[model samples]
Target: MALNSFPPGYTRIPTVSPGPEDYPDDTDALSRSSSPSSSSRRPAWTRSFHLAAAASLFTVCSLAIFSALSATRISLYSQSGHALPLPTHQYFGLETAAVPPCKLWGPGLSEARQNVEAVFYIDFESANDPPLHPDLEDVAVWLEGPARFAADVSYAQKGRYVVRYTALDAGDYRLRVDAFRRTQTGKPYAYWLPLGLDTYNVTVMRQDGSRLRGDGRQELALPKERCRGDEVGSRGRWVRCEDTPLPCTRYGWIWVPRDCIFHIYTPDELAKQDLWIALVGTSVWRGIFFAGVDHLFGPLAANLSAPTSKFWKCWGRLSAESAKMRISYLDFRQQCIADTGALHCSGGDYLANTEKMLGKMAQERGGRGPDLVLWESNDNSHSNYTMLSLYRQWFGPSWTGAFVSAFRTYSPEVPYTHQEAGNIAAYASRNPEAKVETLDISRLGGGLFDTMEFPLKQSATFHWHNKCDYEGMHSCSPVDDMIFQIAVNRAVERQRRLPPRAPTPPATEDVAEDIRFCLQCPPSLDFSMRPEEDVQCFAGLPL
Candidate 1:
């Protein structure tokens, strides 16, 4: 229910490993054999028949096994919109936001003669998407078997919520809960990404410079609290305790492999799931080694410069492998919306590309209403530029709302400046009242971001057009400054001040149609894969 994710474009690699439906039925096959000698003594033809028969039997057994496994799974669905189970004997509690035991909830189980419990611990940090349970009301739980529920809003537990369930019978059963939003609106959802890639350096050294294509080896990545910029890029934080970094690295960057694409040779069915990849503004632009669009304070330097072949090489691979061709650009747009909904755009100066894509769909479908739009990047550059002048008056804030980088943190030619990044942070920090939540659309695909004052339950928005810096043991060409600036605007609007008294209009038939159109918009093609055709300007659609 909570928007606890980040920007999209994850690599969904096709695995040869067994899926949830696959199971080993070799138990029966092995049991039927009295001894290896007897099995080997069977006639060749008979043995072949036995093998084929076992294979067929295994297939059927697998299905039965799957059914049994699924039946035992803690599926938490509710029909009455709500319900509860009585406890046989046990206490209830909440858990932390870690991965193992893996923040799960299950129906009551048993150990020996004693009754066991289901732990409902929500990990806000480890979650890559929105919070499993959004608002408490949006949440509904039911315990199978005879059930009774115990909840106390009366006793103050401080920041966390509490619930308890008990069972009355010995029969086996599960406890389930459906999470949703009950309030009109709530706090934003944020996620922490150890290895965020936006921009980077082409000449960066590998974390250990040991292997050609590894990010080192480690069990868990350390959190930001324990580290900073000095921390290696390949790993979150380098530990002085161990001679090695928190985790080691083979590549100079986080997720970008030596091939430069995470999701390689993916299948179509898993394409949607591969969009979880993201680019974080934790570092500035690295156009010097990336797209060659460094931000210079002067007029001449302002324009994009020639980029190295490596920049295009990396970009080309990323485009083809990413779920949507323009992964970084589109995901950034969606991120802002997912964090806080429409509230993120009160001042309305921020420009997000995914939002523009949705807006274009709404227009194409002939739905009309008050529309605020952000521009798209990579492909359809002019289409985005043209939308600006289409309306005589702008509904959102003007250029004044944009962030202005204050100083240069990077010094190398084409290097990203912290001053540029400062601009984004400054703008967003100034607009704290923007009520930026839900407008973070990217939550539908990847991450979440909240305000700086709060836990960030989501992500930090807004940044100057700085490239991704080479941080950590491993390094990478960071994201483009242009895109970084766009994210900054998106983030700053998180705190934009709104004009009082504008209630949201009712949902109309057009809106319903618009929603459908927005969802159906096919993924954009990669900029590197376009046909070499010239454009003869035909009558194009207008905003």
Candidate 2:
């Protein structure tokens, strides 16, 4: 079977229209000659009996005609036993010639969902367009569903027809259509064909946008040679004519220029890059900062920024650098792992969401992992910050061994703030072989800035309060974001220069000094949060 075509079970039912000679002639209904003259000569009793007998015979014939007409209307049913009403064919007289032959095709998607649309065009053998047949019949298309739902369509363009009806509930749907040509006596003669016969399941998801939930629904999946993007609607490079000297149209392909394309790196290409980072957090990362965050970089730029209702600041420098250096920076800030041990993440679980975001890349690029992943967690936050371990595990053994803590942000709340920072930093410290980095913005006075706005605004300079100076949770300022970006870029670049698969330990002391002056910890410290919790306080004492 073709990847996207309907299965072989799809078949067309043939309907036949009877000719004028098919019905028996009504010889008994013929008028009698000289009826008035004969009645006058006959006896009154004889005339009365003749009238009574004629009346009885006429009533019987009328009843038989009604039964025959009623039998023509047929009811179609879905495979699931949902019944749909077929249109009543009104025939006027006998047909002289046969009904023009045409095939019922489709269940094609329409922008409107309250309807069933199909085509009744005649199939031709040649590549050339065929002329419409003069004797072709008018066709009707209708949709039927569960609960006796029925609708007929009168609107048609040439051989195309659209049957509009009330929005149907979720269930099986069947398409019933007929093409009727007029006999010389004005009688209708045609065929009524059922196209899909419930073999095609019709699942209607039309509230936001219309989508079907059946296996036969159409989705474009272009192979590597056909399109640059792994899936449909993804921005990608198009194969040009010069690339392979192949006709773009012949193999069901179209060539688009590279400049007109959006550069989307496959997962393998991203893994091969000097830097590929994934940001994990909450509303701060998902809705507020992450949406359209990629637009700030690359060739596409709109000065548009996020809503002013939150602590989001533009990442112009970071995005620009990413574009220039071709870095892959991903954000996974959606809510995950509620405080009560529930995994309410998008698409069900952590791994599911991960696959949703990167599975296509895995399929296209042959299973590769990102180079660096920067995750965020706040102890005071509602989420269970320890769930990061599950996320770490989801990445699996190839990427989870390093634990380098280079920066810290501090808050006045002693162990609550310190403990929160320790929970995240210490977790990283335990993984000696994984190439991961942790910087507690809260420990480095990241929470000290004014909660309403960034202290540095759009400044590229790395600046932040050396210690906790603000009262509430130190919301990260614009400077903190920049510092994180700088650290990530630096680490990725350093990793790129490292010997293949060698333990990528910290090589420079620059980051140690960067976080040291911001907050003071004991000269020597165990990577543990609370003495009672039995958790490591730091990755390795940056002091």
Candidate 3:
């Protein structure tokens, strides 16, 4: 019989759409169809039901295939053996066709406890016949959320890259892992360009697995005695100490001066009062600026342009209703020259420019200069020999003059080079009245003296090269974080010594009368206020 033919007891049923309810079985339909009126309806309903079932199965199969091809191929596994779902793939590269493939392995769980360390492993391979991998330094990992910080990245076994970091606060974060390809052109020196990016979601929880409200409480502290100014040991060498525990653990294995404390000021603590901080130095200062801002705020926008002028300046401001803090970075290299552009590393031009910048800041704030000024000499611009000569020549009157001026005005904190630390110490001894305080960051790494001839990697007791670039000139995030911590710690200490201001009175005719008693408030008087409430107040204001 033909394939389309039906049995003799039944009449053929025309095709029709399936209804919401399932049709009766074919055998049941046949029995019911014995009646002439029902025969046509039952068979047609049965056929439609079969067609709908077949279509549904086909649709499911097609969807499964599509998802298998489009879903992310990477896998993430946490230390506790939990697996996290991969996020949808996002493209990041100069050319789509040239983009390489990458695989990631690490803690799969999306949750992490505050102050607990998290580690990730990633590897990249080109799509070419023989896969090529970039160097360890080429990989960059960025963690952004309630707290912004740099992850310590290093090479792992089997060509895998390992990244380690600690979440300082509890919140949702995005961990971005990027692979880059280095390219050098005649115009621009060697630079790395992104080849791909893999982003993962991370939820940092409090130590008890709860949520954290504002910037959480202080995670780490140091002994009060250890918080003094950097000390110099025998032979004028800055006293060295073991690695201190930073909130992020970025400096766990790094060595610093004995007096270096890792007390990071949170945005909540800093938001208490209006402050103006100026960082003056060379290109390295720019990196410090970015690192410092990243720690306090979230990462800066990727499209933000860097300053490129001769006297470049970049400003970052944190504005609150009660407090406003401004961080400004100025290139001091151009300031060391005379008005006629004559180069004099030991001339008064450097001090003149320092005063000029401070004057400008005071004008902006109604005659209040910057509350804190951290100065790092622009030694990166000059050769080691030139710097040594300049340090020697300025040891007498020029050095004393600048220190005296800065001490009297701003109580500036200066971070000196390893070679110059001795000179700074000697100057402090000869001129005890100047009250010179030096933050010795020279022991960290990437100093001008650590050149090719005297490689810090070979001679340093601890591993310092990993935190610095090839030339030992530019430093990575870890070094920058250390410098920022030291600078801010000194700033906080200075702020604590200042006398509390009278509370501001509400705008009223009796405002002056209300604040009269506070006009001569003693410096030793303790206001007993919370950090966030420690704002400057005028004398003629309500208490």
Candidate 4:
């Protein structure tokens, strides 16, 4: 596939159409001359005739000038209706300078190996044209393939530029190069200025120079150390968790933030906890729940219902004699309506529904709330078109900002009122005993800005292309698993710090009695999942 062939819903930068000013101005030439003959030598009637002719000529010239100006104004007004394009090179005072095509020289594309850094050199050398000097900082280099890689660029001796990037997975990848230059006013280009998008197709192979082969049965393990909340939002790249000499598919990679150690608790450690965990959020949280279950227990039964449902609540329980754990997911969007048997929300109040569910959970536990509540709401808040005004302000004239603005204009979801962050803070303050942690999964998937980082904050380019669903709302695999690990680790650490709670009696009813059970399910909760197979689990007898 062409690297420039962006997915549906993305608007490519358009070339600016030539305006009226771009065309040559039409001039109406007028010749003026004075006769040397004196009026005394001519007849009085002749002078009168000459004077009348002069006045007529002046009037004709004035009418012609008015017509020309009116035509130019109409032409410019018509062109203004078309879409505006990026500024031309002449606007940047580089009209005479030639932009030479950037050339790449380094190891062959097939020689790239996984986990090994691939080095390449770029130079703007041409036989016919003189060399061009562009600020290395203005150039942007990134890769699109099975993994996320940021090609590092630095100036070498002379006019050569060295580019370095490491491949994490053995697969085909594309190295995309683009450059941006500021105008005389020092403002960056408002759109993607393509300096050289000479896409290089690279086939990354394992160290053994063999194709990666594996059934999906590889057992994934958690890292020993857990990533902190700050690290979760920090700048980082995706890297294979286990980088053995020989490439293996046993473990998937994780996004490790800068200056942080990211590892999850082992299954043994997770099995030792006896706690009730409640996950309240959008569909993304549903994926995290399944990923956590897969890591803690074995794969779910294949015949279970789909990951999503019309019902508001579902439960996953590990009823072991020694260690008991019950995880309940409350769908903030869905509400069970009595007697209708249809999936619908009443008053469209997500926060109110979430609070109602929490109260119900507490009532079921004999007035004791869940030990830990991992909460998030409206992961699709940025996708709402009504918020385009706010997005334009939040993300200014960068390339990502332009793309986001166009996306909101062209493709937008039904407007959803996002829950206020302060409301979450208030809830956490009210429930001092319970560990109420808010997870910003959107930031992990690059839906929000990273204020601490510059380019990320301004460009919003830290998106995990390979790890996100098509709409870029929910995160797939290792990312979802990472989210689960972080939530569990925080809960475990909080339990160790606080006093042990009095054990509550087992519920008189089974929470999963009406719901189906499944061992096999994709570990992401994006909208593109199995939509046709959704099954509803009605609300059974009240708690």
TM-score of each: 0.21, 0.28, 0.35, 0.39
The residue pairs found clashing in candidate 3 are 77-107, 77-108, 78-107, 78-108, 505-542
Error of 1 at 416 (Å): 8.7
Tell me, by TM-score, which candidate is best: 4
What TM-score does prediction 1 earn? 0.21
User: What would the per-residue lDDT of candidate 4 be over residues 360-477, giving only the tens digit for each residue?
Assistant: 4554433444555664333233222222222122212221101111011000010111123333334445654333334333323321111101121011111111111111112223
Residues 327-396, model 3: lDDT tens digits: 5554343323222434454435444544444444444443344555565542332322122223223223
Q: Which tens-of-lDDT digit does each residue in 1-543 have in candidate 1? A: 111211121111111211111111111222231211221222221111111211110011122232332211212221111110101211112212221222222222121111222233222332323332232222223333221121111111222323233221222333433222222112121122221101111111223322223322222222223211111111111111121121111111111111111111112211222121113111122221122112111111211222322222121111111121112211222112212222232213223333343243233212321121222211111111122222212222331122211222221111122223333334335554441111111110000111011111222112112211111101111223222222322332222343332332223334321111011111232211111122111111101
Better of 3 and 4 by TM-score: 4
What are the lDDT figures for the candidates, one per model? 0.21, 0.28, 0.35, 0.35
- Residues 1-543, candidate 2: write the lDDT tens digits: 001111122111111222221111111212312112111222221111111211110011122232232121212111111011111222211231343334434433222342232222233232222222323333333333321222333334444334444332333454443333322322221121111111123444444555645421132122223222212112211222212222111111122221222122222222234443434332233221222222122112212122231112211101111211222222333335555556455334434645444433222112334444455454333424444555555555544222223222332111134345555556556653344445543322311222111111111011221111111111212223333333343344335333333223222444321111111111222211111111111112212
Output the worst ten-in-a-row residue range by lDDT, candidate 1.
443-452
Q: After superposition, how far is residue 99 of candidate 1 from its true place, in Å?
A: 52
RMSD of each: 26.5, 35.6, 27.9, 28.8
Candidate 4 Cα lDDT to native: 0.35
